[model samples]
Target: MPDPELPVITLEELGVLRAVHVRGTDSVEVELTPTYTGCPAIEAMSTDIERVLREHGMRKVSVHTVLSPAWSTDDISAEGRRKLREFGIAPPRVRQASGPKEPVAVELGPTRTSRPVAGPPELAPVPDPVCCPHCGSADTELLSRFSSTACKALRRCLACREPFDHFKEL
Candidate 1:
């Protein structure tokens, strides 16, 4: 089934549909991971899965929400990213590798609060610019941190001057 939020790509391509297993002749089990905790689409997705599977002749369909391996933006497939761009949404950058040797790293380089503190401010790591999916320009500015959906950020391209939603990094 296609992702409800980003209909341009299927749930399989989005990496949300983790696995499918057949317990018996007519019973099937599906594993799904949500993009984030308390994702609003999970219910809809689950219902869709059950209906589709049942229509396909499965007497019983069970969709289990798996949260052990938390979902990330990196879970998106290359094809899914291309579809997102074609759909006029900037895809998120791949931030981490999925391996036991490599772990998710966080760097609190610098921060500014109401008050100042200490020596000269240290520079934080700069993130690669989010390229405009339409104009293919790296000259885009964030208009809002949260767009129509919490998972996306609204931005406008300097070259095209068109406002668009960007799938935010998880």
Candidate 2:
């Protein structure tokens, strides 16, 4: 089924449909992983899954949320990424197999911020450029840390002057 928010992708494409198990030939149990903690779409997805199963003549349907191992952006299928781009949304960058290389160093000097920060000057390392899904240009600027969903960030492409949502990494 298509995701309620991002209808361009399916639950399996989003990598949240972790597993399904048949128990005692009468009931079925589904395992799901949320994109992030406290994801609101999780409930809707679960309900949809249960309803669909029920329609298929399954009386007992259960959807169990899984948190262990966590959900990673890398879980997004290649088809999902293509779909996101086709739908004008920037998909999350594929994480390096070698893992993140750059580490945000704690600067002991004055940093660029309006308020006096308490912790490290840079809370996170400079993120890789979020390319424009429409123009496929790397010239983009982050508009907000959060967008329509917590799992996505708002970004504007400098090349095409278009605003789009980018699936957040991790």
C-alpha lDDT of all candidate models, in order: 0.86, 0.83
lDDT of 1: 0.86
Residue 24 shift from truth in candidate 1, angstroms: 2.8
Clashing pairs in 1: none
Can you write out model 1's per-residue Cα lDDT over 54-108, one digit (the tens) per residue?
9989998999999968888888999999999999999998886555323556534
In the order shown, the candidates' Cα RMSDs to the true structure are: 4.2, 5.6
Top candidate when judged by TM-score against the true structure? 1
Off by over 4 Å in 2: 24-26, 98-127
Task: Work out the TM-score per prediction.
Answer: 0.86, 0.80
Worst 10 residues of 2 by lDDT: 107-116
